[model samples]
Target: MLHIFCPHCGELRSEEEFHASGQAHIARPLDPAACSDEEWGTYMFYRDNPRGIHHELWDHVAGCRQYFNVTRNTVTYEILETYKIGEKPQVTADGKQTNAPSTVKGQGEKV
Candidate 1:
């Protein structure tokens, strides 16, 4: 079992004490009523399922009962860092910021 360090509790605890929530830092729509059906649907259902580095939200369920962010490697299952919700992650894939969209090489032919 993996031992996770709780930011709030300031102690390392077992995995059973924490609940792995979905992707962290998801921004909720400011005006939900104004959002289109597609936008709202994407907000509710869409999440990043990348292969390498992943940032996740974890709740200290059995300990402090507070939520925090964990930067972990998906392939090796290694926990890189555990931080508070508002804090930015230090480790990133390829040392590049992943917020921007990657460029596609080919263009579609006109029909």
Candidate 2:
């Protein structure tokens, strides 16, 4: 099982309380109408399922219903951080944080 932090509620909850949405920090096309069909297709279908240090978007569906981001090691299932939506996670260059997201990977724990 995985733990997810809810930035709003400031609690670490079971992964069951949250749901993984997909890769995070994606920028929308500047001009959707001007994009070629292939470009649109790729944006709609292409996803990078990296094995390590992946950034993902998740929703607190059963808890606060707020969207947030997570940095986790897919291979180890270790959560590096969690942050509220609309902000970049304050990840250090070495992949550490002075204040990690308020949620936990398997349970909500205060940092």
The segments of candidate 2 whose C-alpha lies over 4 angstroms from its true place after superposition are 92-111
Pairs of residues at least 3 apart in sequence or in different chains that clash in candidate 2: 3-105, 3-106, 5-103, 12-108
Question: In model 1, what are the clashing residue pairs, if there are any?
Answer: none
TM-score, predicted candidate 1 vs. hidden true structure: 0.83
Candidate 2: tens digits of C-alpha lDDT, residues 20-106: 899888878999999999999988888889777777898999988988888777777877778776766655434665474443333
Which run of 10 residues does model 2 get worst, by summed lDDT?
102-111
What is the per-residue lDDT of model 1 for residues 1-111, given as tens digits with 9 covering 90 to 100?
Answer: 688888787787778888999998899999999999999999999999988788899999998899988877777777777778777766675434445343212111111
Report the CA-based lDDT of candidate 1 relative to the real structure.
0.76
Q: Which stretches of candidate 1 lie over 4 Å from their true place?
A: 95-111
lDDT of 1 at 43: 98
What is the TM-score of each predicted model, taking all chains together? 0.83, 0.80
lDDT of 1 at 29: 99
Cα deviation of 16, candidate 2, in Å: 0.5
Cand. 2 Cα-lDDT: 0.74
